[model samples]
Target: MVAKSAKLTQLIQAVDGQKVHQIRCGDHRFIDVTIVQTQGRFFVRQYKFSKRSWYDAFINNPTIDGLPNGAMKIGDLEVQINGKVPEDLQSMTPSVNQAYRKLLGLVYPLMRLTFDRQKHEATTLELIPVFDH
Candidate 1:
């Protein structure tokens, strides 16, 4: 018989081992593969159940140059892995911000998977922008 626990170990384990990597795209662009911060690192790793792991990927750093113009991508998706949340997001490199906003859209499903904020608070301190991708 299964254990008398409401929690399954697989889900718990999956939520404990997510990962990401980074790489440089040509001269100015830096690429990344990041797990959402709210998910607790390694808790919801990308690729879910793919062959390669984060250790097998490139871990790029935050780019600030014209890198966004040439941001890295996998398949049809551009990686908008911002290493830091800038204090003034608008003052950010337009391209990177654009890239990030593009990425922000994709995170909706992932974000919904974890937490649902109170509508009011969620709307109030919103700083992240959206892109038309």
Candidate 2:
């Protein structure tokens, strides 16, 4: 794991309680994402197969112009991505997943987010923080 810089730590604390935030993949436009912070790490799960562009983007090219290709922006602070979490440790806790489902219901009342634990577990991606130099 990369050491967390003061800026990165502050950014994590600032958004840890929030259910949703905007993330940008490479040069793609920012998209609303459900983020969760656990074990001093941040994670984003692909709730649906159709919404896998961000994941695909990262896998295709994790870096661009020698800089990280992904980022999560919270106001003026941006947390750079180190890379995806390994498959073995990608799954979030059940409670965390339940909370995410509740958040989705509140955030998108018209849309129904399914509760397929297996699928969600497979889609979870940890946002390893890139420490500032």
Candidate 3:
């Protein structure tokens, strides 16, 4: 199992306590991420802000660098994107879809006017915590 940093542990606790909605990286970047823990394992979901899908980029090049270091690196962490896709594909819940809509609405009001459900499902990148073997 990969080790979880003290800072990350604290941040997770705070998030679970409903204290924060975003995570800060070592590069001093704040990303809106949803922390998920199941069966005693931790995971993170990162939203893609670019108009173009990162699916191709991630698939073509899995090794990633410049990961934000909030709890963990705070400025020195290189990560790999294990998997990425729209969250709706993972959880077919109306609420999740609605939440994505609301999030998009906040950024691009024009998106709220029309609904191309399949085309613009919120792009979510799923990161699994792992320790080097």
My TM-score estimates for the predictions, one after another, are 0.20, 0.70, 0.36
lDDT of candidate 1 at residue 46, scale 0 to 100: 32
Model 1 ranges with Cα > 4 A deviation: 1-18, 23-35, 39-76, 80-85, 88-130
Clash count for candidate 2 is: 0
lDDT by residue (1-133, candidate 3, tens digit) is 4356753464345434441244333334444454443322334333444543233344344434533212321223433224434344556334444444433446435643565544444444444333331
lDDT, model 1, position 79: 34
- Indicate the residue-level lDDT of 20 in model 1: 38
Of models 2 and 3, which has the larger TM-score?
A: 2
The clash count of every prediction, one per candidate, is 12, 0, 6
Which clashing pairs does model 2 show? none
Model 1 — which ten-residue stretch has the worst lDDT?
A: 121-130
Write model 2 residue lDDT over 1-133, tens digit each, in one string.
Answer: 5455766678767666566687877767888887776556676777656645777667667564446668887666777775464555634555455555555656543333455666666666767666552
60 Cα displacement, candidate 2 (Å): 2.1
lDDT (C-alpha, whole model) for all candidates: 0.31, 0.65, 0.40
* Candidate 3: segments with Cα more than 4 A from true spot: 1-53, 62-81, 86-110, 131-133
Decide which is better by lDDT, 1 or 2. 2
